[model samples]
Target: MKRSSFFSVSLAIAGAAALAVAVTAPASAATPSAATPDTSGVYSVHPIVEKAGLSTSAVTPSLTPAQCLAQTAGRVACQTPDSIRAAYDIPATINGVPAGTGQTVVIVDAFGSPTVQSDLAAFSGAFGLPTPNLTVYYPGGKPTWTGKKTQTGWAEETSLDVQWAHAVAPGANIALVVAANDRGATIDNAIKYAVDNKLGNVLSMSFGEADNLIKSPNANNGQTAQGVKALAQGAAQGMSLFASSGDSGSDNGAGFANYAFPASDLNVTSVGGTNLWAGSGLNQPRETVWGDFANCPLTCAFGVVGETGGAPSLFTSKQGSDVAYNASVYTGVLTYLGFLGGANNGLYFFGGTSAGSPQWAALTADTIQAVGHTVGNVGQQAQSWASKGLLYDVTVGSNTTPTFSGGYSATAGWDRPTGWGTPDVNGIIAALK
Candidate 1:
């Protein structure tokens, strides 16, 4: 799901678990402004919000990057695959191999996109990238579409995961395992299938549920236990695993501090969110912990904006996020999707830690190529890199929201929100054991 939808879903989960926090609007709220090039150093564009009665089937034509900027006065940064690669200093080839040439990345999602293959091809062609070695699998058989909004959201997510993972590591093979549904056990079953089949050396899960909710007596389904077992098996076999921490700031939309499950599990590397400024001319790339706390009126109340989840877990001593990546809707990356129907088959800007996880998994593919073998459990390696000043340290911004006062802050070293910080991919590749 996109971050906005996920926000409402997380809050709904919290409500079901009796962890929902009450939100009260302040008397005089400030509306968020459009992005300013002078301050942010990137051309900005805002999303066209779907109105109450608008149809999503309208034929929205694709726009150029320049057109994207000129079309809106909203405050948001737009990025391309080339710009992201340049920003991170990721090499086209690691060692003698073209980045992820021999590796594979497995993406787990529910209700996979109907048009992902074509969408991925279009995305690659638009960005001058090679066609990916892609395959899609369904553990519980292909899902019959009900045309539900949730299904559409998952389809968008599927496109984002498949496209961006390939964008980051164009040479890697991709294995997309579609779950029958979003149910805990069902999702776990897909994961178990991937592990049993040895689908890939790197895996990414771009979804998560609230930690407290997963552990609640009324909600625990043994799914977390089953997921952990499957992930542990993958780890033992040298697969690097990743999951998005969440998109609802540190409190995770619960009105109090909590963490997201799967990501909260110590076995997985929890990827967090950041606002990225890919440098141009004289400006250097910069990042900050992703949060829109101060932009509360439309951002917080509607939960349509983006925020990174980073806090100590209610279930474990481990932090919720181990590393961060660009995830601000205000600073989102471009994605191609044809599954929206009608003329909506075009490029759109998307953000969320969901964008981060697949890219991280792609980075792991390169890491595997560089090291001549798979490296499991990147969290420990990332910590070691941070200790050596090898990663990009994000020391600004906070994940606190108006309702959740106990939210975590970004700090000099390892902190809850961004953990060791964003990856300097090349530096990490060089520093890998």
Candidate 2:
């Protein structure tokens, strides 16, 4: 049976404010920039709840764009691993090749998930994918959930990272490194630990703060220094780091163009988001730089002011995302997060650059496996491949918010919103080869 036949039947179901500051001090007496806790301290994780209610009986299911965006009986439609592979033109097997068989993809997050292993087992089983050789490491210490918001949020983020990375590269091993706390210093320690231990060749980081926030008067230089050092060390070890560009568009809740940190760091491949439409079986897919500005007027929570992230950077010349994938809640991806309260043992729809980062890392694992070795610099390799037309370039849409005029729009080539655009796995593999 063609999976496309079920696409329509499956289709029926689916689916912040800030303060100002005063500057009255002299130049020398000016306060040092402190990291903005709202934007820079902890990464933003956006979970979309069905307007109806949460369900425990619904298993993880894949939905097409038509089914996911429908208003009536809005089911939790999200892209499944197979749907993603099909949409991106990734081969079921590379030349009957066992790509990523022995490779490792490491995921770093704060305050580990207690049910990650079990949750992953269920996700893989539902999809008929192999169980990953997974290991959870806590460099600081095991997280004490204590029902804290940060802990719970990280637990959800951890599940998204692990499942999606495995989904993209089912053969690769995964190392999940969890920080004891959500502090910049604690997360930095976890990253350094991963680098020092040579945990993996590709690392996916879904947590980040706004770059401008980190440059605030209260910013911690020590934490920033440590983060920079860790990136250098990871690169030196042949590890390719990937971080989410963020979900708050350009404003980042600051009513201005504020880029997310770590993502803005030069050593990392910053991934943005997109709205993907997987065409029928064997039909070509279509994608646009993810922005929901047009649909925000009546149905949007933030009205018509929301968008994906893209802005100038204070840290490096690479000003925006290197690539993108489905990150909008309206065109979300499916994952199992049964650990959350009120979430039955069912699947949920998730969007944001958080979803994009891990999938990119997983694809990188495939590239490494195809090349039979880790690329010295995955970010540079991606650019080179993109130049050769190994990626799908998105030329439509913009990540513009109502108040921020500084955001970039998608154009013919690399733009701030989606740098080189989305990946073409086969083309990338061939280019890397």
Candidate 3:
């Protein structure tokens, strides 16, 4: 299943669960903009909203970093930038050099968020991080908001991408390029515009379409063809493209084994998900492939049985995922989403590979700052890092489900669920430097 669609289906199944505790919209709640169409059926924005046990009357009040951590008892755990930095062993300064001072990370999403700037401001203020240099561009055209679920979903995704990218590399400039719609051409044009204009060195894509949708009898769709060319051009020009593997375990939502496009495309670095557990003060103690079915409410709102996307690619030359991150919503990152409107305002928890891609992009910006040059073809760079034993290999967990015919499990080295596992940021920076 493509991520956005997967989340939609999950929400439908758990609609009752959400309603039981969903926060009530305010009387003056802003009307959501029009929904983005799923033209490719594969390019859905990836942000799994957890609606269980939420208040129905008012937005959760702002919480200090300490307060947020204190509420993590049988509730969704919200991570701060300090915690992520500590968990990943990311240094305050790398090689006596600062991180991502002048570098820019470009985030590509559909139906740009109307309040991304304000949302990012809230997020930085909450975490006490410096405000980031940010810009938003509509390469194809301004999105048409039909007041559909797609619009709101992508708005959340935009918030997740911008906030976390800045969270990881606070000094990096951010350029958000939103496609007019989810149509393949529109998205490709947005990406090409970013590349042609040299907007940023790292491009973070938190959306994907199923590879099977573009293969065989449907080959003429030309959905992924143009995007592939643009990504290749970006890579050749010393840009790093990062995409989420997906939210679906292995099934393509049509009950067949498949991988997500763009991420499946070899030119991009496919980031997978992981179950990350941190000790007191956000010290990372245990990390594994993020296949937690029992704790679905915390990580996913879909009926239990959600897993990280992992499998052999039926569409591309390279394997599925190249790196992993703390994508489990149970232990998800906290980001502000002012665009949601009403009681859904303030900090919210987000999971899925959608949360991971931008984090990796931020990490890439940090790497570029450390190396003093853009590291082109991040997927290839991941391979180099893996060879030098720089990655934390996850040897447990499986993405298999009785509902899906084909799936992969985490193994000794590169397996489906966790690819080369998560990166050791300090090690990656040291090795690349």
Question: So what's the TM-score on candidate 3?
Answer: 0.83
lDDT of each: 0.70, 0.68, 0.70
Better of 2 and 3 by TM-score: 3
Q: Which stretches in model 3 have alpha-carbon errors above 4 Å?
A: 1-42, 51-70, 93-98, 216-219, 280-285, 294-305
Residue range 48-138, candidate 2, lDDT tens digits: 3222222323323453444433432232234777788877866556546444677888999888788899888888887767877899998
Ten-residue segment with the worst summed lDDT in candidate 2? 1-10
Which parts of model 2 have CA positions greater than 4 angstroms off?
Answer: 1-77, 95-99, 216-220, 280-285, 294-306, 341-343
Candidate 1 Cα deviation (angstroms), residue 130: 0.5
List the pairs of residues colliding in candidate 3.
Answer: 24-56, 33-147, 34-145, 34-146, 34-147, 35-146, 42-209
Candidate 3 local distance difference test against the native: 0.70
The true-structure Cα RMSD of candidate 3 reads: 7.1
Specify the poorest-scoring 10-residue window by lDDT in model 1. 39-48
- Best candidate (score: TM-score): 3
Per-residue lDDT of candidate 3, residues 1-433 (tens digit): 3333222211111221221222222233121122223454447765866543232122232332234334433344456687788778776555554467778999998898888898888777766667778988987778776548578888888989999998888888999999988776788888899999889889999887766556532265565677888888998888989999887676545455667778887788898888776533445436767765422434233344246776667766756788888887666776776765685566566788889899989988898888788888777766678888878878767665545646777788788777887877888888866
Q: Write the per-residue lDDT of candidate 1 for residues 275-374, one digit (tens) a residue.
A: 7755422142387788777332212433446578888887776776898888875556777767667644566657778888999999889878887777
